[model samples]
Target: MFDYLGGNFPTIDRRSKKQMKDVEMVAQLLLFLEEGVRAYSQEYLDKAFSDRDISWDAKEEVEKEFCNTVKAIKEILDLSQDINLSKTRLKNQADFYSLFGAIAELNRENEKLTITRDIGVRINNFLKLVGDTELKNQSKDSLTDYQRNALEYYEAVKFSFTDAGTRKTRIRIMKSVIRGNIN
Candidate 1:
C-alpha cells in the first residue's frame, strides 16, 4: 500500500479497504490456479486415449482461461477511488480471511487430484512390470489393491499439482500489512 505524498515523508496505507480487496482477489486467483485448471485438464485427459498427446493448443486454451479469470478478478483489486469498500462487500481483513477459507477448500481438492495422478503413474508402472518374468516372480503381494486400482483408474483421470501454498502464505502475510506491521 502506497500513499503518493505527505511532505517529504512517504506514507503507508495498509488499512485501506482497497488493498485488502486486492489481497482477497489474489487469494482467489491462487485457489483457481491450484484447483480449477487442473480439474479441467483432468476431465479432458480422462476422455482422451492413454497414448494420446494433449496438444499445446488445448493447453494454451486452459492457460488463457486462467489468465482471463485472474484479470477479471483483478478489477476488485484495482483500488480505484470510485470503488466503495462497504462493510457488506468484503471490505476488511476478516473478510479477506473468509475468502482464504474458500481458497483452502480449493487447495484440498487440488491435493486430492494430485494424489489421483500419482497413483495412476504407479499403476501404469506396475502394469508394465507384470509382463516381465523376473519382476512378477519377485513379488505377488507387493502392490496392494489400492495401488493396482490406481493405475487402472488412470485411464479415466489426470491430476495437476498447482503450487499455491506460497500464495496462501502471502495472503496470511497480507494481514500484517493491513495492520501496519510490515513495511
Candidate 2:
C-alpha cells in the first residue's frame, strides 16, 4: 500500500499499466516482508527466554537494510527518470531479487531464534508439568505467577504455529493483506 510509503512518493496512477504492475509487485513483496518481520518480532516477545542473551541488533540492522532497499526501488520508479519502462522493469526485478535474498537471510536468522526459544519453552513447560505436578497437587498453592504466565504464552504460540487449520487461515489472511484486499 502507498500508505506504507509515509507520503514519501507521489501517487502512481499516471504510470503505464506494465510499470504500475511492476510497482505493485514490488509493493506487495515489501509488505510481505514487513508483515513477516512484525509477526516474528511479536512471537519473539511472547516466547523468548533470556531475551537479553539474544542479539537483537541484527534484526534492527536488517530492518534498516530493508528500508533502504525499498527506497532505492521507489527511486527507480520515479517518473522523472528517463529510463524506458522495460529497462525499469528489469531493474526493478533485479532489485526485487536482491531484496528477496536479503529477506531470506533475515528469515534464516529469525528462524534460528524462534527454534531456540521454542525448545526452551517446551522444555520448561515439560519440566513444570511432570516434575512439579505432584508438588502442586499435594499443596494448596496454585501455579506460580511465572509458571502460569509461561504456560499461557507457550500455549498461545504453539497453537498459533502448529495447527494446520490455523496455518491455512493465516496464509489466506496474509495473501489478502499483501494483495491490498484487506485493511
lDDT of each: 0.33, 0.37
Write model 2 residue lDDT over 20-64, tens digit each, in one string.
654544443443444442332334433432352475544565566
**Candidate 1 local lDDT, 86-144, one digit each (tens):** 22223333333323333334334453211223222332243343234454343436855
Q: Which residue pairs show collisions in model 2?
A: none
| Per-model TM values vs. the true structure | 0.20, 0.23
Model 2 spans with C-alpha error above 4 angstroms: 1-55, 79-95, 99-183
The prediction achieving the highest lDDT against the true structure is 2
Candidate 1: segments with Cα more than 4 A from true spot: 1-57, 79-183
Question: RMSD of candidate 2 to the true fold?
Answer: 20.4
lDDT of 2 at 104: 40
